[model samples]
Target: MVAPMGYLPQLMYGALITLGVALSAVLFGAAFGLLGAMAKLSASRPLRAVAEAYTIVVRGTPDLIIILIVFFGGTIALTRLFGRTVEVSEFGAGVASLAFVFGAYATEIFRGAIRAVPVGQIEAARALSLPAPILFLRIVLPQAWRVALPAFGNQSIILLKQTSLISVVGLEELMRSASMAAGATREPFKWYLAAACLYLVMTGLSTILLRLAERRANLGYERR
Candidate 1:
């Protein structure tokens, strides 16, 4: 009914790789999202248009398609740019693709979070003669983060699960490892079940950590 204990270590390693990919993707995505949010909120029409276009295109496309495009299209583009063949690693492609997708969604989340911060608070910060950087660092970002945490956490969990898609690109993540094991052992059900359980464990732990982070972020604030 259960997989052989011998295979557990390999699956665990694969899970670690999966987590690494998710974290890297999320970090890169968050950076992009921050920039996108700023652009969306800026007065510059061209910047706003570009950010809007990025979100619309990424959100409209399927994740699998995005992954394939980045893996194949990126290689082709790089080859053309360099006038030589270029090979893109599965890991890099996976991270970049997922980050691009994540950034699109995170852009809206951050934009909404930023907007949720009361205009009065910003006015008050300016009233205090605080510099722009200090005002954002000390006031705006803290509140925005508190507001964004739940949505961001949800996105991170989604990102974690999305790492499985990288298996299609031959990343040897948990799903890929399990599939290979299943093929060798001819135990599809057992290996797939193991992979599912590992994913559940990862997601479950992430939920707990996210809840803790949410609580920490909400410290000294009234909870509704």
Candidate 2:
């Protein structure tokens, strides 16, 4: 089958958009994840409850619904606050929606990692009179990262694939662009196969990076 001649450039553009959105979402999501984890472990009951509620609600809903609600609802809230009509860019909405979803799932990963840190270690830190900040920085966080890495990597991969859903909002992601190419060329199979190959490349590279991180993190640990 003759490949669609001009589809390559458009597919490349969509690939860049997908990567850009995922990268932004991951950075912001990490901040939300850390705070959510800290609140989950907080002494204040209200704070813990609020964090729990956030995770439960987000996880319970389908990702498509969450994206639509956050996108449309966010636009309405922003318009009311600013008292001016402003159009929300599809790219911006996609980033915020995906980031919110990613953060909710990351809360679980973070909370588990924090719990995995040995209680004895925290007790020893308290016995040594280490301040909260010092203890978290020097003792708790490093160990938590080691425990959290595998889950975090899985979440990262999920988020990357979730970028495809942004096409529903007409964000011109890889899938959307491929669809457009197929329509113009009247060759759906050719364009879709190209899109799949691009996705495979992105995911394969991510897997390699994750493996490297796992190796470095497990350094000096006793092999089972």
Candidate 3:
């Protein structure tokens, strides 16, 4: 049992919040990615261009810049729209920015995964006269899910670490909490070390879960 001291409890709470934010961002990002991937793969030229522009811009920019943009830009936009002062909270801004970045990468991941699906299967499905929706739900999505899992897991882990950046906006996630505690206690190394350990624990757990998921996703492949 660890000795109770110096805002460890608060830091733990903050870590939980960090996890929640990362997860929420990933969920939202996945939705954005699915649409973006569809647009990229679609026959429509304008949609493909729009999706191309989104990925290129987002991928080229730094995550920190994006965070700042979402944080300050959202507040400004909201205030202008409402004709009054509007403050965007750190949590909302952080999640939205992170989701935006994550979606850009995820769009590529999903697109690649979809492309990786065996073309022969799609031809067979068409030959069988399966509706496009049914074909995707029954066949394409499962293989894409498997192919995308490894990349998705890596992206999730990166997003988890990036949660620390939210500290700059004053969200009381682990990094911010540790910074405050370290300052108050004048023990920067100790508090920051604790924060690092907590992050490692979270990432380690995520890695393990991801491996398990990968194994499950590969079960059919193994059997064959």
Candidate 4:
């Protein structure tokens, strides 16, 4: 079959799906990362232990295995709960799996960034009798975000590229679209090349944006 000239449009549709999934995964992952980081830093031993377990287990497992578990195991759980056959959508499973993996790594990044915030500042906040929330919000978080930006950006890019893995779950994200086009037309080189270029454009744009944000984040410190 001759591949349609509209293949680019199909790829664009898939690209949009990829973008949506990646953004959703990162937002959800950031929540987990923040919570996990705080847990790891908590005074409560139980909280620390739970956080450790999460990072260790998720990081220890390959992402594909985790994707499979969420994709299939979720259905099983839902089936039992509802007393009927239930299915998990590929989009849901893919996003969840990616989020879990991204969170595990981001947890460590956040933990280190939080700790990198000077302790004396926190102590001074306490000396001034500032409430904990105010101290964290006003002093700690801003600095921590600056410290974490480079690492966080790198991890985010990795998560973006990892969106390709969702093709396995049959979500028609970019890579899957390219693969199908290639298979159908038997023009493997051009289709795959197009996919690679699309990915490069996506990653390149993100890198530029991250760099701009990093510069903005540094402006305050650079002034001092």
Candidate 5:
């Protein structure tokens, strides 16, 4: 059975919020992931150590625990350090929490991609006396992005689904909105099914996009 007509607006609005949060997190996460990947591959020991530590801590913890720490513990930590009142929006906290988690996974994907780049190519660039930035920009990043696409796409889809965890912090995404509707209408089955279908729709679209990206990235590598 479908959700009541009255719940349509709420469900749509919640979906929009979910999309917004996922986008924000993914953007920041990509940036952080790139930086982390570079750091992990850097010659500097301290940089590598820091990058590894960050990945270890994030991957070692549960995502829901991270969200709670960011939403609740973050406030306490910030207030103490800043010596002033600090408040973060539930949406912002959700975005930040998910971004950090997403970034950790993305870092591994990017690092692997970077490693897959032929060392000889980098050596060739160095022999030609190309600046490091130029070598990376003109040669390294293109191939790395292609190599990373599948893993990045996977992370993106995971992050999108993970947005549901934000509801615990009281940001009214699809799950929270559906829960409220179910409570109000006393029809848990319908609203919950609606939420599940909405999530499946999002996942389906992401799957299609990822497949397209993979095909595009692998075009040059296809054998005749």
Candidate 6:
């Protein structure tokens, strides 16, 4: 099926937007994930409970529902709080919701990775009189990062795909562009297939880069 003659450029632009949104969301998600993981690991029961609840609630709900609630509900709440209209852009809503979802998953990934690091190593670092920050940065984080890389990469791919949900909020991302083109051209199969191919390319490239990152992270370790 032939797509409309002038649609490819628009679609490509949309794909770029999708990439930008995915990257931005991942960064935000990583920040949230680190905080959540620390909170969950804290000695304080209330902090642990809050982190647990965040992960359970976000992970249990559908991504689309989260997007809608954050976008619409947040907008309403902000408007009411400020006593004025508050508008949330599709991009903002998309990033916030996806980041939140990604963070929940990442929290578990990071927490498990942190736990996997040898407790003896931490004890040894403390015995050397290393500052807490130095001990964490020099000893704990490097090992934990190696353990977390694979899961984090997987979550990143999932986050990339989730950007499609932004279309519902009127974002002109790849899926939205393909949808609009399909409506206008009456060639749903062609446009949709194109979008799928684009997504495949993005994920494929991402996999290669992530594998390289994993190898780099594994440096100095004995190969199995």
Candidate number of the best TM-score:
6
Per-residue CA lDDT of model 6 for 162-182, tens digit only, reads 899999999999999999889
Runs in model 3 deviating more than 4 A are 1-4
Alpha carbon lDDT at 95, candidate 3 = 98
Clashing pairs in 1: none
* Model 4 agreement with the true structure over 30-58: per-residue lDDT tens digits: 98999999999999999999999999999
What are the clash counts of all predictions, listed in order? 0, 0, 0, 0, 0, 0
**In terms of TM-score, how similar is model 1 to the real structure?**
0.95
> Of the pair 4 and 5, which is ahead by lDDT?
4
* Candidate 2 segments exceeding 4 Å error: 1-3
TM-score of each: 0.95, 0.95, 0.95, 0.96, 0.93, 0.96
TM-score of 5: 0.93
* Candidate of highest lDDT: 3
C-alpha lDDT values of all predictions: 0.93, 0.90, 0.95, 0.93, 0.91, 0.94
Q: Where does candidate 6 clash, by residue pair?
A: none
Worst 10 residues of 3 by lDDT: 1-10
Off by over 4 Å in 5: 1-3
- Candidate 5, 71-93: lDDT as tens digits: 98888888898998787789989
RMSD values, in order shown? 2.3, 2.1, 2.6, 1.6, 2.4, 1.9
For lDDT, candidate 2 versus 5, the one ahead is 5
> In model 4, what lDDT does residue 120 have?
97
lDDT of 2 by residue, 54-155 (tens): 999999989988888777888898899899976678899899988888899888898999999999999999999999999999999899999999989889
TM-score of 2: 0.95
